[model samples]
Target: MPLPLHHLRAGIIGTGFIAPVHIEALKRLGVQVTAISGSTKGTQALAEQWGTPEVYGDYDYQSLINSPNVDVVHITSPNRVHVEQSLAALAAGKHVVCEKPLGMTTEETAKVVAAAAASDRVFAVNYLCRFYPAILQMRAMVQRGELGRIIHVQGHFFQDWLLKDTDYNWRVLSSEGGKLRAVGDIGTHWIDAVSFILGARAKSVFATLETFHKTRYRPTGEVQTFTSQSDPASMVPYEVDTEDFGSVLLKFGQADHGHVSGTHANCAISQVAAGWKCSLYVGIYGTKGSVQWEFQQPNEIQAGYRDQPNQVLTRNTAGFDKDVANFTDNPGGHAEGFPDGHKMHYRAVYEHIASGKSTPVLYATADDGHYEVKLCEAILRSSEKQTWVGV
Candidate 1:
């Protein structure tokens, strides 16, 4: 319980696909994932596969939290369990790093924000997209007025994982995923990224949400993400309560400076474009120039100006700003993709926690996660009422 949290012991609370990513990132930061909690199906195997020293049943997550072997808890479970488990860990004086939509609703998130504020333990939210080197560069440009007078922002987070009617997952069920699927799962990332870059919060949102296939077939057996069983004989169709797609129009708060029309800037977000897989595209248009970044091109940014030729700014360019270039892990040609984003994010968290210092702006804290929930609630309200709602 002190400074220099290097070699910290971590307890992970889920064995889903996201858990492995967290494990890998923690490993890169010299953290030991000493324990894990999971369902009976694969708990042992997952522990063995990852070389975790101990395992707990899903119901025993609290026991894992109380164990002396764990110093931190990483909650990667379904939406319904995040707030409860995180509260437990905070109450136990353990630091926490929970997945996005930290709480399913604004009310739940408020409780988490309050609890974290009252405690001395570190709390982080996983909004990994912000850690990309290209994204850091974009933020620097906006901060330096390199993209003078920000005018508009637009982005989309698309995936083909649920494109087929046979796709099935807990996310489609409101009981597990909350009232929103597409917006909560992926749209938050899009919203968080642009907000982080522009240094603004969404003031209002006009939105529409839709579920293309009201029902989908679930295979009788287990299945992984992005892969679905197509056999009708073994698949059973069930009604889906959450949306598969969402589009939102957003108005942002005014920045201190560098805004074209003060609070008049707007943004649009999408999660259901066909044929696109895990694509997160964000662009900011300003009076002087414009810049765009895509997850597919994580190492480069497309920038254009009114009178000059457009340039693609790759990471680690010699003439680039030093602060932005520091985010680059290697020379210009070496690419840093999704996994690297996770690593950089965890590194920031590790550095802050290890130093026993105040939380840095570079890491997404519970407060930031709560604001994202506020925006999500407004989006849902607007979609239902067919009018703009304050965020």
Candidate 2:
């Protein structure tokens, strides 16, 4: 297991935007955050501000992994550093929770998985959405035959953050984010969710991806971003080697039966449209009725049928499903959001270590990361050759 919660000393690597999210989750779990590491001065300052002792700004990554105070490594580094850092931490005999899309590419991701499998340590990917209360409820609903037999699933995930010409990150670059940015970064989460929820593997897909904003702005003065999120006028063109919007025409084979009736069908994921803020929209069509869920609204479940009135199922209330209803910890009126999902994820991870629960089977692992990377490659191949590529 993961040394008892009281004894677990966690250290975070890379203090970018998501680092704080990890720290906050650990706080809720009552785990200690002993140290933090980053390659940037601003990140080091943020770590100090957060009261993490023994801060390491320019320290060697391997030394940080080998630190005597650390019992687990919660990796929040960039895509490129995920594998190397994870391998180092795992080799140092620390349990690891690496961020999603486990590594820069499938080859690298598999190496991390191989290392984890070779060790006795607990290794997992942080695809936190699966632990969302609503999603948990939906998984239970599908299992209980509330939806009859899943027929078709239509998923859409989009955000307007990159809609502006000035928005840029290493993610927009191919070497950093790989050949497919949208499909790799966020799309894999959707794919992992569908596989876990519907319990199906994609058989094949036909895809089309593009970089609509071919040229982006660069900072005229010293700015935070490598290119620029400001200084729109003094912008320079950066070749977008990666695609911004990824449209995958998916076909999933028979995997889970009797929950939802999808004899054989499709779903899609798009990240560069507009106005979507980290939403996981699922439309499950079944024989008797259909259920819909959007991650943004985690407290309620939408259900519809031919003979009866459509209803909204709220948590801890009469309108909810039996499986998920059992885990409701709140009464009516309190609110839960994305961070709650992370909490649920951490709870599962903790339970796996503490109680030896089999839920770890459902959590994302490095192999999923490997397959997701291969899937992205297949998507690119299918898009280029105008043919279906099998996963």
Best candidate, lDDT = 1
lDDT of 1 by residue, 1-391 (tens): 3235456899989878898899988887678889988786667778888899888975579988999999889999888989999999999999999998798888898999999999998899999998998888788788888888888887778887887778788787889888978888888898888888888888988899988888788876656555667777788889988888877888888766555333343343333466788898898998889999999888888998989999988788854537554345678788779888998888777777777766465978999999998888888999999998998
Alpha-carbon local distance difference test for all models: 0.82, 0.73
Candidate 1 structure, TM-score to reference: 0.94
* Candidate 1 ranges beyond 4 A from true positions: 1-5, 257-272, 319-321
Every model's TM-score: 0.94, 0.91
Clashing pairs for predicted structure model 2, backbone only: 149-260, 149-261, 150-260, 150-261, 150-262, 151-261, 151-262
All-Cα superposition RMSD per candidate: 2.4, 2.9
Worst 10 residues of 1 by lDDT: 260-269
Q: Against the true structure, candidate 1 has what lDDT?
A: 0.82
lDDT of 1 at 115: 97
- Using TM-score as the measure, which candidate wins? 1
